[model samples]
Target: MNILNKTILVTGACGYKGTVLVAKLLKAGYKVIAFDIQWFGNHLKPHDNLTVVKGDVRFPATIPFEGTDAIIHLASIANDPCGDLDPKLTWEVSALATMQLADHAVRNGIKHFIYASSGSVYGVKEEENVTEELTLEPLSEYNKTKMVSERVLLSYSDKMVVQIVRPATVCGLSPRMRLDVAVNMLTMQAIKNGKITVFGGEQSRPNIHIDDITDLYMFFLERPNVTGIFNAGFENITIAEIAEILACKTNAEIITTPSNDPRSYRVNSDKLLATGFKPKKSVEIAIGEVIDAYEKGILVDKEEYYNLNWMQKAIL
Candidate 1:
């Protein structure tokens, strides 16, 4: 599965993580096809090796099984808030279609298939931190669908090589930007308004940069034999520490509130590390980016943010 010169298809290409990874793959000499139902066109990466295909994954026409060496499944109702918006569509497109994609790819002779699962699958790790072996207790709709979809995809292990990477709450830069995440939101609030609302600071959740996430995919794409599910994330920090540091960068105030343990506990990515993979960007680096974006006046309006509506519906 050496991606060099291999034709690779990246779903959700316009998304934060997908966009970054698509660019990386294209730059690394992989034949890249980008697919997405919609586009933040202004943020689209202009590349010679990239071919943009506007399509949805739910429909068979969009799967593009032919001539595809690997399928990176990133298309879905990503955030918990967005998934709960329309439960039925979420399953049909995000969960059910993953199974359909696997069937299409494997039956069509696609070599490698990767699923972007979430750390939220491990709800609340009763024991301080969680690991890949921990039993899943997904508390939200998006993660529930992810867990179900993962099971369905894994069923094809005998037919074709399938791999899953359960990334922690991803933060940092993206072409199609989103500030609905904890780090992004805190940095925006502190910079614009000089204050940040903190919730459940005591809870430690694993976090990783958007770039590092793409790196994980590249590693697996190059070494397809590295199969199975692996956890991805660097340090597990509490909401309070994040708020404090973000405020430090912005010279803003910190506001703490009730339990807002929206997703999960911390996770141990040791298993993934054993695969000779180390995250290039850390949580601290993500913080720096957020602060830099804030100072540079790039933080968009709350209403204009892609994830604002989704977050409001779920958090409220």
Candidate 2:
């Protein structure tokens, strides 16, 4: 798409994945407009072509959409527990805001729209391979919001290149690191407490390294023609399997406990791979990198790292 001179607006630019993606965008020489509520604090380093805007996505008019060639919508309440805390707020930020943004994008003549949807939207699938064709059965308010947002964005596909990526639970390090997800959370537990907790270990969940998922966004950004819902997870392993990998790496104890959560499914990214997108990282590599960061003092266990804990204190 020759994005060298193109300007891209990235919502949630201060978030876990957003921070990394924004940085990469700038490094790749694309003009970037970073929009965020800054609920967690902006960790994005200053760049020559970067424009950081503190604004709410609910009001699309407030966002600086002028001269924007594409939109990478990443803003949302994020996670099941945090989304559950305020269902109304989640709907406003996650779903309605997306509708507003897509409408604005169409009006503004922004051609490329890449949405960060959740793999959790296909909630609790019985099939071994949960493809994008499967009917969405969103269980939580968060999942439902993502599902609704996807539908809303898809409705505008004719006007713009609507590329939706249903990414698996992301792991690895970021400027705004999150220890709440499966891989990062268990890795932190093993590193800090010397114990890895496994709840309902048999339930398989798909996972992708943070780098791969972020890279997938850039992939979609460059190829605006390749549009549609595509899963982005590479590893489909159980909770126990993840814990065992961490335990071996950190010599931590594996503690099995009962879990009633029950939400589990393996996401297949075959469609994504067929489009020439290659995943270069794994869960084991993510665990190793996180451990390296912790040991090197680049990362730590903080209140903001856990979304539910921080959101309860900051937003609620």
Candidate 3:
């Protein structure tokens, strides 16, 4: 699939991951239509090939799907806390909207659909390597919505090439920076407060850099034949390990505390790697990038950077 002159429709285009992905699409000579609700604010710069549309993904009729060669679905009530804030809204935007979009793509003769599914869908797995074949035991409304959305999209596999990526907790800098995720949050705490807090430092979590995840989207866009659910996390480390890295880089103190949240899982991206996809960044690199961004004043800890806080004040 030569992406030259092809138009790609990206949902949640102004978001943390979508913002980076949209920019990459435009640079690769693909005409992009970025659709978003703009809950936080639009951070995407004006481009000749980019069309930014302010709209809700819940309303599929409002989506600009005409002349779209592919759809990269990234819109949803992101994270567990925000999804739990309003269960009805989460289901409407995440699951129901995905169903409608897949159906609409089929009707409009769109041949490719790439979905952004979460690695957390394999909730609290005890297995050493959480593979795509593992049973999904989603623990939150957000995870359940992603699981349901994946199933819904897979149903249309016969009609189109469906690529589902179960990416681990994404970290790193973006045009729309997010400071709420584990790596970025702890890094910011170290930079701003000179201390890093680790709640149950032994709990391990898988992570992928924002650049690698967005690059994976471009890889999928070029290879429409690679269709199925594939994990995209490259690094699996403990909370203490991440904190130790940040502490080393910023000369910050590490404070460990007890935590009731024992949920921990390590994702394996062997399947995705087998497809010739190479991840170029790591969790430590993501932390370093965030620290550099803050030191250089390119990023800040804002109220909107925390999804739960912003949604509580504005949306909820």
TM-score for all predictions? 0.92, 0.98, 0.98
Query: Model 3: per-residue lDDT, tens digit, 18-101?
Result: 999999999989999999999989999999999999999988899999999999999999999999998999999999999999
Candidate 1: tens digits of C-alpha lDDT, residues 102-141: 8888778987888899988887667766888889888888
Evaluate candidate 2 by giving its C-alpha RMSD to the native, one decimal.
1.1
Kindly provide the TM-score of model 2 when superposed on the true structure, using C-alpha atoms.
0.98
For all candidates in order, the CA lDDT equals 0.80, 0.93, 0.93
**Candidate 3, backbone clash total:** 0
Q: How much is the lDDT of residue 313 in candidate 2?
A: 94
**Candidate 2: worst-modelled 10 consecutive residues by lDDT:** 260-269
The residue pairs in collision within model 3 are none
Candidate 1 clash pair list: none
Ranking by TM-score: 3, 2, 1
